[model samples]
Target: MIDQSLIDLWHGFGVAFQFHNLMWSFFGVLVGNLIGVLPGMGAMSAMSMLLPLTYVMNPVSAILMLAGIFYGSQYGGAIGAILLNLPCHPPHAVTCIDGYPLTKRGKGGTALGITMISSFFAASVGIIVMIFASPLLVQIAFKFGPAELFSIMLVGLIAGGTMSRGAPIKGVSMTVLGLILGMVGTDVNSGVQRFTFGFPDLADNLEIVALALGLFGVAEFLLNVNRMGAVGSNMKLGMKDMRPSRAELKTAFWPMVRGTLMGMLFGAMPGTGPTITTFLSYSVEKKISKNPRSFGTGNIAGVAAPEAASHSKTQVDFIPTMSLGIPGDPVMALILGALLIQGIQPGPQLITEHADIFWGLIASFWIGNILLIILNVPLIGVWVKMLRVPYKYLFPLAMVFICVGVFTTQNSLFRVGEVAVFGILGAILLLLKFPVSPILLGYVLGPMLEENFRRALLISDGSLQVFVATPISATFIGISCLLILLQLLFWLRNLMRARKVRESAGVPT
Candidate 1:
């Protein structure tokens, strides 16, 4: 079956490589890279902006262009994150932890190269996984009841929560806060108004672009303003500085392999996103490192691992979106929306009914990744030059982009106002030493968790025991419980160790 599918995929390349689709893929990738270079304009926004333009084209061609935009932006996002301490996209926020440090250490170019190499390798591996794993995953997805889905989401949330670097309490707090924010809109089943506070603009849900811009983009700029001189002094820009030695590449290779596996698995899971997977990849890298304490200060594995996971995750997100019609996150949601607009429904029947569309899109991932590598290597020096720009002048421009991008998202000034609201909130959280990533993870997963839970209850006639009745659901719940228990044990063990040290030092007892 896999062999036949590979043959079909080869046929897909034949279709994708047609003159028209090929041209659109190249053009789309170029445009997406430009969009990624500009902070706050995520791939979803870029695809949304381009959705109407695709209406005039054929379905396969349209999809080719949009997919190009999404995966191409993977590399472009790293540029802003490393060079300016700006994530430019949510997944890249994970990159900022070590990527910015590397940039500060005058290894911006080398960091960018690792991002490119790891991304290329990971994306290649992701495509291979998609080719082989889609059939298997979709089969399992068919067996997944709402309870199983809910249980999986629970573990995902817990895994994300425990991965925080600072106080675990702060991470959990932010995640809970994100869940509250996710509840701000009207309920889908009951049609009841939620925490909207009478604001009609939130009748659907909070805008992702607005939240991301304010939390990561605007808040980051505000924090940087006071430290402009220090930021400027740290960046060393040149071609030579970008190259890494044999040791660095060798160290990052195995981490990249591990990160790719994580990305392929999590990225294919419904409701999961690259941001979470990147965080998980970073967590895994730190966990396995011989010198774990060196992670945040500037570790190449830190840069390679998360970047690899994020890039691969972006591509594999298409697996469920294309195979089961289950979107992993908002970007996949938009991609799904685009297919619906094209009068195509993606599901188990997708490959059988629309073989060309399915295969063509798969083949396009390869082309887009290649084009991105070709574009990215040469653009490293140019991206590094951006660091030399004075923050005093650059930040105001960033604010303008944030405002404009938010407004364009919904054609509402109200959404722009939401940026200020979240910006202040994010700034406060940053000052309080809270982990902001959990907030995002919470916000993204909260809706899915609720939807799945309700669906499960409805299917089981409101019986609470239904969650444990099914084998898959029971397995997931059991795993989630075990994971939480293990984390608790670790936390308690650390607490006792700290207490012992304090007692010995006579500081406190």
Candidate 2:
């Protein structure tokens, strides 16, 4: 199977290596890097902006470019986080902990170098996993009925809550809120409006583009503005400072490998995203490190681990999205949407029917990673300098691009307004110290969860026991239960420890 897949992938490379495909891929990397360097611009916004242009190109070339944009920006995102203390995307947030400190210590170039090397290594591993594991994963995907899917989605939601930095209750509430917001549009099953509030445009549904822009872009802009007064004014990178020392590389090497493995596992799981992968990788590295106290400082391992995991997950995310048509994230959903528009159905038959696309996409991952390594490292100085651009000038341009992109999606101003509203909501959530990632996760997965849960209920005639009847579903439920129990125990132990500390201090418990 591996050899056959490689042969098919080579056939795909034959197509992807063409002049037009290569050019688009380059264009995508360029655009993605620009967006990634700029604060607040995410992959979804970048993809949404480019979605229309794809109609004019060959579907294969277009998809290759889009895929490049998706992961290429990841390389750039680390630059912004490390140099500017501004994370362009959510997953890049973890990099800020150590990356920015490295920059502050005049090692911005070194941080960028380690980030590039680690990302490339992790991406290579992830792409290999995608190529080999997809077939088996697809077969298992086929066995999932609606109930099983719903169960999986529930597990994802719960996992997101458990992963939160704040109160689990708050995370759960936010997820529920996201679900309620997701339900606001017209119901597909009954064709009845749920929460449109008499708005004709909204009767169709809230556009994910608008929401994502508002949440990530607009909200991020506001937050940046709030901190503008204290932000660093200079962005400079010396050539000598950019290169990592032999010791730095030696330290980061194993951590990168560990992060790559962790990312591959998590990314292959449905509904998990790079944010979780990065956080988990960072925590794991810290736990196992000889100098764990240096984690949040300027530790090179801190930068390498999360950055590698974040990039690796991009490759792994395609596994479920391509094979089962179950989008692991919003970006995957957009890719899946593009596949559908091209008249290519995603599932088990996808590999057999469109071998070229499957193999081409897989091969392109390898090509794109090579391109990113080539383009990003030498240009690290240029990207580091991007932080010098004033937020006042940069943010307005970003908003313009965002508005134009949102408007262009459907040629509607209402959609642009929707983006603004969501942006405000995102800002408020950020101010309240609430996590925004779960909201998007919930919104993206909510409808699917509902559809699957209903389908399972119908199949079982409303008897819930069917969930336990299937071996796969039973296993999923069992794992979910165990995870919940473990988390509960951890929480209780922490609470008891806190009470004991307070008692020791002679404070009221």
Candidate 3:
């Protein structure tokens, strides 16, 4: 089986390396990278905008380019996070925790180097997993029904509650707020208008692009506009500084491996895209680190882990979408739509029937990652140079980009207005020491949670026992309960320890 797979893969290389196909792949990644660097723009929007072009192109090359764009944008998102502290994509948002601090300390180049290395390593692993394990992974994914998916999302939300830099309660509060915001728009089940508040523009849910850009990009600009002059003026990086030292590489290596494992685990599961995987990777690193306090203080592992997870998840996300005709996220959904337009059906037979599209795409993953490395690595100096622009000029230009990008998502001015409102809310969260990351996580998973739970109830005729009847659903619920219990124990330990400290200092309780 392995031998035949290798032969087919070699043939796939032939198809992918054809001049026109290669150029399309290059153009896709090039555009994707640019979109990733800009705030408010998302891979879904870029793919959506270019989706029409696929109608006139070869189906094989069309998918190759679109797939390239999807993952290429992921690579570009880290650049914005590392340099400007703007998480152009939610998955890379965790990178800003350490990446921007590295920039402040004149280590932006080293951070970018680590990000590139981790990304390449993780992508390679994910591609290999996709090649060998697609059949088995698809089986596991099939076991997940609405109940199982809902339970797992519950676990994700609980885990997300731990993502904040300040008090866990603050993180939980922000996550709940995100859930509330996610409720804006019409409910799918009843077709009733929700938090839309009589606005026709919000008949659909709030655009995630607007929410993410507002919270991270516009909010950062608002809070820092006064201090922008001194922010990057002292940043000095050269080619020499871009290379990671032995110690830094050593620190990042294990985290990269751990993160890749996490990505591979979650990537094959539909609806759990790179964003949750990245957050989970960051949380795991913080939990296992010898000094967790150093996580937000430019720890190399903090950057390496999440970037690796995001890229790995991005690569493996192709598994279910292509193999089982189930998209892992909205971006994959768009790609699936493109395939349908080409009169191709995706399923188990796709490999035997559409061999060229499947294998050629696998081969293009190698080419696209190589192209991204070439574009991002040698150009680190150029990316870092953007920071040197005076704050007076940069912030306004970024806002313009933000507005334009948000508007492009659906061509609605109302979405741009949504960005402004979230920007003010984000600034308030920052001032109050609330973690904004969880809010995005909650928003991403909230609707999924609601849909799956209601679907499960409907399927079981309002019986709650269906949630635990399946092994997968029950296992996830067990994990969620364990997480909550552990959190309670941790809080108890802290409260008791605080009393001891007070007693030692002879202070009143």
Candidate 4:
């Protein structure tokens, strides 16, 4: 099997290395890189816009190009996250936690450099995993049902609840608020509107693009308007200044490795996309760090781990899609639709039947990663220079991009207005000393949690024991409990410490 796979992969290179296919790959990554730097534009929008062009192209070249755009956007997303605090991609929201802090510290270039390195490293590992272990991983992925999914997502929410830089109560409160906001749309099971009041637009729930851009991008703009400062304005943009020091590199290396492993694992599982892995990766890094307080203060590991996880998970997301005829996320569904348009079916037999398409796509992954590294590494200075643009000029331009991006998501002016509303809300949260990242987390996970939880209950006729009936779900439940317990214990310890200090100073507790 291994030898056969090798021979087929070599033949795939023969197909992917063709002149036309190479051009397609280059064009896709180039365009994707550019789109990624823009606020609100993501790989899905870019690919959807270009999906029509694939109808006239060969299957091999079409998939290669789309695949390139997908991963290439992953590479470019860190730039906006690091340099401008705009999460051009959902996963990049985690990057903003540390990436923007690094930018404020004049290490934006170093953050971008580390981003590229981690991206390539994680993509390489993910490609290898796709090549050799996809079948086994697909089988494992099939074992997870609604009960298992709900339990694991519960774990994610519990862990991710502490993703703020402030007090735990505030973080948890923001997360709960996000969950409530996530419930804005019509109920999926009952078809009853929950929070729309009287608006038709709320029936589909709030757009993730609008929510993310509003909370992070527009809010930052509002808070900083007329403050008269460009990010990293005083930093030197020399090549040496952009490069990470040896110490920084060492600090980031292990996090990249760990994040890649997590990405590969979660990416192979259907329904668990890059967003969960990125947040979980960031949470794990914080949990295990010796200086956890430094996490939101420009920790390189915080940036490296989540970026690596997001990239690797993106690359490995193809496993369940190609092997089980399952689309892990909406973007993968689009790719699957493209394959269907080509009169191709994805399943276990796909590798044996469509060897060229399978292997060529794999080979293109390598080519695409190399192309991204070549295209973006030298452009670190160029991206960082956006910071040098006058704040008055830059914020308005960014707001335009954010508005356009949100509007394009549904061709709705209502979505644009939603951005302004959320922006105002975000500014208020910022003033209240609340963290915004957890809100995104709660919004993303809340619906899924509700859906899966309901599905599990329905399956078990309302018996909650179904949650722990399986080993996988049971294990996750255990982890969630342990996490909650640990959090409570830590809170108690901090309260006692505060009391001791107050007593010593003869002040009120």
Q: Per-residue lDDT tens digits of candidate 2, residues 353-413?
A: 9877777888888888888878876776676665556777767776786777677667799
For residues 88-206, write the lDDT of model 1, one tens digit per residue.
Answer: 77778778778878878878788987888899899998888788788776665567667887887777677667566687778788889888988988898899989888889889789
Q: What's the lDDT for all of these models?
A: 0.81, 0.77, 0.88, 0.89
Q: Return whichever of 1 and 3 wins on TM-score.
A: 3
How close to the true structure is residue 244 of candidate 3, measured as C-alpha lDDT? 95
Which predicted model would earn the best lDDT? 4
Off by over 4 Å in 4: none
Error of 2 at 483 (Å): 3.7
Order by TM-score, highest first: 4, 3, 1, 2
Off by over 4 Å in 2: 1-21, 35-63, 73-115, 130-134, 224-230, 234-236, 239-361, 501-509
Query: Between candidates 1 and 4, which one is better according to lDDT?
Result: 4
C-alpha TM-score for every candidate: 0.90, 0.76, 0.96, 0.98
Q: Which pairs of residues clash in candidate 2, taking residues 3 or more apart in a chain or in different chains?
A: 109-242, 214-423
List the candidate 3 regions with Cα displacement exceeding 4 Å.
228-230
Candidate 3: C-alpha RMSD to true structure equals: 1.6
What's the lDDT for residue 288 in model 4?
Answer: 90
Pairs with steric clashes in candidate 3: none
Error of 1 at 391 (Å): 1.0
Candidate achieving the largest TM-score: 4
Worst 10 residues of 1 by lDDT: 227-236
